[model samples]
Target: MTGHGSGDLRERPRVLVIAEAANPEWVSVPLVGWSLATALRDVADVHIVTQVRNREAFLRAGEVEGESFTAIDSEALARPMWKLGEALRMGQGKGWTMMQAVAALSYPHFERLVWKTFGADLEAGRFDVVHRVTPLSPTAPSPLAAKCAGVGVPFVMGPLNGGVPWPKGFDAERRREKEWLSYLRGAYKALPGRRATLRHASAIITGSRHTASEVPDAFAEKCVYIPENGIDPARFSLVADPQGDVLRACFVGRMVPYKGPDMLLEAALPLLKAGRMRIEMIGDGPMLPGLKAFAEAEGVAGQIGFHGWLAHERVQEVMAGCHLLSFPSVREFGGGVVLEAMALGVVPMIVDYAGPGELVDARLGIKVAIGTRAEIVEGFGAALRRAAESPQALCRMSAAGRDEIAARFTWARKAEQVREVYDWVLGRSEKPAPFG
Candidate 1:
């Protein structure tokens, strides 16, 4: 087996990573960036160019020794007046805007702009490979990969989720499906650069086999299955706290419309009413106002605690106290918090959606079916009830969850797998086989 810091001549490949953001504090993309940086450090001089959302938090997190960091100012992309006009147009079109439509149609032009700006840096030939952690964002042009291709640099695009169709048995309702079709049409209309992007990429990293199955047929051959996010097992271990009375269940991550935080609340409300569990929501987002209102209306306000925007370490501490982590997002690539909780022996209860379902096996955690809103609510409610009634079962699941992480999902292991991809891209004969 190759050691972490072998520094053999076969190692030390120079690579550049481009993403919208790359802070550990920035959720999914950052988690991907951090893990990749750490994994590739021994084998590559990794340089990450990403948008900086929070400058201080990013700086304080420090850098991976063999990795270099560059912050791309994306404030230029967030033109408020332009956004206002776009929003007005979208409202006029029934939540669909013409600018977005135009953007989609002119995606090639957008990709050109990205190349003009970031391509010059890569043209210097300092890096052998270019990896984009997240693709399909308007903010980061896919054409950048094409630029890398022009410079003879292998471009790896990925860890992409959400854009792909949901897995089988997890279909959206008719109404939602219609809405999704409209959104897909708009996406195609708005992002013309996708084909060119895929054409230039040497490989595409997907979070799971489920996501890999959704890769465009043209690029399907180049798709590689890799968990886009991971946890440091040493930092997050199974240290059960016996004194905590409330079987505290926590949900952490951005509170967005599709994230399904409200579903978790709805499921927990009846359990709280029955005096079965206490809930702690340790994140903030647009859904907070409505979720808070719903909690009050359900008369379970006292049983729920909302901790808005806790830092990453604070979140780990919160996970330590919690008995289970509940995430009911309709769309996700990989749930970083799910792995974090599992590493800490907090069994996960996730919606049977893309990311969580892929990560949470029966031994490690529970998966609730997600069909309709009512079905989601009922499924989660039943899981919560089962967890509340069986303390021993929770403990068993928690232990299994930690063991699973140690056996299969550590950053070190994930890094080794990624190094194999790097070796394959380098035209080496000693390529590691595709993960089963």
Candidate 2:
């Protein structure tokens, strides 16, 4: 088990999946990383390469370290650097500027470890491809792109996402979030290996229009847009059955300024006060106290359920009981919860701007156009009122959203799409038509 199988040269292409963050015990980027890596197995023979931190969890999940996945013991270099960055970050995302620096330091070691262990096999054509599937952050450069190209093995990067700019007129929110280095976010285009990675990559998959546009014009041909989020249909086994007579709406996300949880409350106040609708506010963050107080002050607290930060499964259960997921995050990157809601047949109402905006069209759910904070709040309220009053219309949207998810947004579907890309890269097929 100390070595890997070089996959039969005539069989399915062997792929090395690199995801430093991939671990089943974790959530967020790690969950996406792990899921995507595992999903690739249905289409290609794959060996995942990840960090030492994920080893125990990987083993617990039934993976044999050297064979199924390569656990790169890079913590000696990664942990200290992470600690230093966290200290400097000081609980402020600051547009993720500090973390990008930390990533610049740590991510390379992951690539180095991969090459150190498998460079010989790669050189001998043991694997047909190398795909770096994590650090989903586009800012993190993969030194392996150049290395892979040098040996004639195609390298693919991304589903890289991030850098969605804040909606206009939210400077206060920007400062509140300690986005000090936001102004220089554009400087990432100048990172030492960024351009080369794009230039040499066999393909670059982007998760958002913002991320797609980040690729330079010259490398645009290689850029492909595929959302970085998907749902496990089993997690949303709750049929679209309502719990009560009132058409309930739910908002699930961190109670942060950018997330617009306050806007959900402000928008739903009229319906919540009238007993025509109920609200379930899930998840917790710095904005929780204020959101609770705001509901009480507006006299709609009785109609709203404040269940802060439920487990993922519980969140789905709560979502199943509701008719819609109302999210107004101005800077959302994935609107992942929205997809989960859709998978459960709960329609979503999201601000039409960044990630959520791109995902929702007239068919999926509601898109509240981006505008001044006041305008967005008013638009969300109107959307809530409309959905609350019309059961038939809301049901139609719910069915359509779930159908859309089942048809195009599941991991199974994404892997098939990725398979298409592989065919294109290997000359087994022509460039794929754009994702519909």
Candidate 3:
């Protein structure tokens, strides 16, 4: 496809977005996809290819304004035999082995199916650029990147999660990450075509400077730090509640091991014990039962409320009522929830690690020091006490937090940065320009 230009400036280009999952109900990925689509609409013809878990829910969610949506049926590639083998292996307590085997056996076939089903239109050179949002493993590059390359289109690889080596510290965790890396290396060797596909991509976009720095010195030159996530400041703005009672704290998003819901429960125990605060958990996941049990055991059961999973609109409403947002997650590229809380004028008490460390300004919110369970508990307790003792301080931090997000983080700004990367990849720009 030929590039479009208006006068001396390039016209809005057509961009194809590929993601394994983009169901709106799925949380993070969907939000990222939707935001990107919305932001790029003015400058590009955006077409998205993503798997829909629930067709009805997806349809109900409707198309993001100004972008074309294409739904890929995952059922078409759900190999029963592979699933059975994986299930059996998982039953035997070999989860990683099972996952690896299934991915190795099924990914290529799945990729082929996706191509046969959707590649013709894509390969016809209808899109000027291709962007992959969820690059979890080499499988992400296997057929998608290869197809884009085959068509002579510039491919942007990014928002990729796994494969990068974990940071130092946490001996047991590091050992497991090394093992996973070993397996990934073997998998890549076995799938040379997939490896080459990703290596040939025009550029790789990452969510943070931390991720961009860790992009393997081999691809470091190709790596670009363009945050693909942010909060909708307007949606999370502060609200006036004349009858609001008790200090409400909220935990939003998935309840998983790395998310540190357990940490929040532990930290809230002392506050709850003292009847100083009420906790509201607005999401559900595998860790819900454990979190609930811990809260009950700590004698704060009555004070805690679990709203399960709520719609996006409702979540914003719940957030508006919150006095603070407590996120204890240990692993995150950057927590969009933290930004959401900040935008909503809720002080965030986040762990001093990864995402929070990078985004949280001490002047805006508390960054609890990373340490043992007792230390974390103590640190969070101290932050809570500080907020409680000084309402004026909390108000100041809340205003600053909102101001910071408005000034630095926004989907419009993030999308424009991504578009610049696309522009550079397509040879429209000679050098990477600052994404204002």
TM-score of each: 0.77, 0.95, 0.78
Q: Identify the superior model by TM-score, candidate 1 or candidate 3.
A: 3
lDDT, model 2, position 315: 86
Candidate numbers sorted by lDDT from highest down: 2, 1, 3
Q: Give per-residue CA lDDT, model 3, range 76-131, as digits (tens).
A: 55557457755655333233434554555555555565577657767777778877
lDDT of 1 by residue, 1-436 (tens): 0113445476476777665445566555556666666566666666666554534555677653223565554454434534654554533222222344433343334345445555766687667777776443322337677677788888877665544354444344223322334335424523455667777878777777765665578777787777666777656754655344456788887675566788888877878887778887988866689888998998999888888888767777877788888888776656777888888888888887777877887878899986877788889988888878865568888889788777767877776677677777778645455664
Q: How many clashing residue pairs appear in each of the predictions shown?
A: 7, 1, 0
Cα lDDT computed for each candidate against the true fold: 0.67, 0.83, 0.65
Q: Across residues 256-292, which tens digit of lDDT does each residue of candidate 2 receive?
A: 8988888888887778888888988998888899988
Winner on lDDT between 2 and 3 is 2
**How many residue pairs clash in model 1?**
7
State residue 133's C-alpha deviation in candidate 1, in Å. 2.4
Candidate ranking (TM-score, best to worst): 2, 3, 1
Maximum-TM-score candidate: 2
* Candidate 2 ranges with C-alpha deviation above 4 Å: 1-11, 92-95
